[model samples]
Target: MSIQSGQSAIEILGPEQPESAAILSAQALQLVEELAERFNVRRDELLQLRLEKQAQIDNGKLPDFLPETASIRNSDWQILGIPADLQDRRVEITGPVERKMVINALNADVKVFMADFEDSLAPAWDKVVQGQANLRDAIRREIDFTHPTTGKSYALRPDPAVLIARVRGLHLDEVHLHWQGRPIAGALVDFGLYFFHNYQQLLDNGSGPYFYVPKLQSHLEARWWAEVFAYTEERFGLQPGTIKATCLIETLPAVFEMDEILYELRNNIVGLNCGRWDYIFSYIKTLRNHSDRVLPDRQAVTMEKPFLNAYSRLLIRTCHRRGALAMGGMAAFIPAKDPAKQEWVLNKVHADKELEAKNGHDGTWVAHPGLADTAMAVMDQYIGELPNQMAISRDSDAPISAQELLEPCQGEATEAGMRANIRIAVQYIEAWISGNGCVPIYGLMEDAATAEISRASIWQWIKHGTHLDNGQLVTVQLFEKMLLEELVTVREELGEARYENGRFGEASELFRSLTSAKELTDFLTLPGYQILTQKTVA
Candidate 1:
């Protein structure tokens, strides 16, 4: 356990663990220690606030915009202008921070590349440290890789995409790096190490340190980041606005507090993104106890749905009204092996991007490099040389209410949905356990958050006794039956040799553990993290 330091305390459950000494050098450790000793308490307090809020929600308290911050919402205010590099971000590509991925994402023909250390990464100790090293090399244009067998060498372009590093959320901890026998917050470790090492180098190359803040739940969390940025800039002798960030309004509560969230980080924030998958997971978790709020099949939740549309429009309205870019959601579809299927998927992505562009989104996200051009072309058609579509009036007439945003999708749960939830959850968890956070499953790039959605949806359905359109109820017996069937399908798909070698059995157990719990688990990765670190897959 951590010893008390004045008012701050961080306790480590286990004894000191060792990993990643390169990124945990004396100087980097000092910076991380400073952040942990100062802000870990506040982080804990905010997390406690989350629990309290969940309790209120469990008791049937529907989330709404704060009455106290109503004036802030109604007031006309804008974030400080963004750096020039970020101005025309029509399309942004995102991926894990492996060396090859870093190089490819930077060299891709996109406006920005989000080097993700969060959802798309498994966050093993080596990955955490090496991902930092990878980003540093990419920033310096020193990153390169040669395919082991293909004899093909890859390098960065002369003008790579603008880089934005996304650190982990506040709930995670870097157990490998400890300060005075206590683990530091993973967010601090990730953002601090990257910022401490590469802030100046990025600025020297004509871009500053930009970020995508993930999984923020309220304005207070945004305020915490603002304080961190202020301290970091002052500590590193950079200008106050040297760091620009885009917050992902991924949580249901955050959707309500969008304006307030931007207000807290007003000077440093440049945009807000729609974290569609995590938002759905959060929605399910938030309303898990409320039978009336149960959602339909995962495929049934589309952007055109009422709740999602309301959320997206409200985000655009909020960001544009504040002079911040309102970025669109991720196009998760990857290319299928068949050319016809790939073309169909690309066209679907084009339509999605077109809707976003027409709806006044300044930028959008794509998971694969192949879709970047498709997304950008759609944006080009709608935006037409403008950096963003914020000047277009998008939300003046169609005002959204809290009820509209909270309104659940009207569709029946089906056996297909349940089977898909099981199959996807098991496959994703298996891949995740193998240290891959993002996998192209059924031509869509799925991360741990998608697995969360699957398991949480299953849990909610079983808990609420949701009935399918075909008149079958979502019960434990039915779920178990579907899970067994999906397991057989997964085995056959992977082939016997590969199935036995991978972590499918363990993944199935993990998925069952997550969904069959009496209480909703907070994060699918939390328990899986232990499994990942403890064992090595063959």
Candidate 2:
């Protein structure tokens, strides 16, 4: 394929050696050879490793026994962090740094653990394959995901069978490979080809690695993945249909075509992942065609009907229709601070689980290990019970107070956690206008550093009391008052962190929005004050 971006994984990562990627790839193959040389009777051995790897991924037969069912109940039993279904078979992940995250997730008794290659990884190319190689070798040797906090790891390397193998390990129920939004056939195609090229035959027969496909926007894309799988399988001398796939329903366009995508990938598809952010962004960019009105906060719209909510519902229906699992996305990276931040995060986790159960998602991805307890707690609380049929309100989407949102922490929210969000919003406004890396808002990073964080907060907060379903702020007026105060605080702290640094071409527009978030808050206080403020933004 032609290089549209003028960079492949190699050039982007800036390696130590002249050809680190090539060397790494060859080294990975050599490692497989050694494993084979050690065990492969007399062949090149990659065939054997490939066969084993492929079998692990291709194996679709889930055991017949069912773990205890999770509750859909509103009360009776409750906990925090954990989701109901998660209790049966917990799901967690690991990235480049948090090597112990997997072990920790499993040690917490989680059921599924993903060794993530996307998002969390920087993919420096030269040594990019090193981790995957290390992880795969570790898995072949049967490594366990351990919990760092408790000093406890998942079940054995050789003892009782372990379900918590490193994600993409040599052996596991699924071997999910990924690609972000890059156009080189994106992550899935690129990784899938790499997998097939590298590990087609060493794979044993009964099972094979599974693929978690992402960013697919159309039925054609799903079909294309299936076709790619077919080609890869054929090239590797494997059975024509030995691969399984999960379509990540992250983008807005993909959501619209969930049914068709599922239909296209039906037999091979195993689950649907709700990608909250990118999908929301897509909605704003797409739905504008259908409306004259402007959009609101990003988070609020996730559950909004006539658009996102419809897609979410379709997701559950489509997954269940195909006897597949429906998975929820992350709770927007919540920080781990004191009890208050923890509790606030727990609430968001609860909300996700609640929505998952309500919408029929089987499980969700808990992004951080620290939040595992929150995920687990929620699961424990609901696992033994069922939702209150009577408690199921028509206004399930009804907004609640900000205090209620942070209730688990019980008034202990530090200025950081308590005012964390509003501060970030101010920082973003300042930085966006300033065209800088990050702007300090009350001693916090608000540019790209916390842009997503701020945006996510606004998205969730806006939906608190409105049918509009966006991020909630007590009031734009109250928020503005806080914003101004934070600005003063930042200037005191940074010396150079001032509104004046916001001197970009976009500053005028950004300032207008900053004024709007505040003016709107101010107007909300006026007698019968209409929301006359121009759109103030983060």
Clashes (backbone N, CA, C under 3 Å), per candidate, total 0, 71
Per-residue CA lDDT of model 1 for 1-538, tens digit only, reads 4323222233323333243444445666667778887788899899999999999999989998899888998888888788999999999999999989998998888999999999999987667778998888888888999999998999988989999999999998777555666567889988888988888898998899999999999999999999999998899898888999999999999999999989899889999999999999999999889888999988889888899988988899888888899999999998788989988998899888987887789999999998888998899888886888889656565789999999978887888888888998999999887889989887789997888999999899889888888898888778888888899999998899989999998999988878888899999889888887763211
Q: Which 10-residue window in model 1 sums to the lowest lDDT?
A: 3-12
lDDT of 2: 0.41
What TM-score would every model get versus the actual structure? 0.95, 0.53
Cα lDDT of all candidates, in order? 0.86, 0.41
Q: Kindly report which residue stretches of model 2 are placed more than 4 angstroms away from their true locations once superposed.
A: 1-23, 26-90, 94-108, 142-207, 288-293, 302-306, 333-335, 377-538
Write down the lDDT that model 1 would get.
0.86
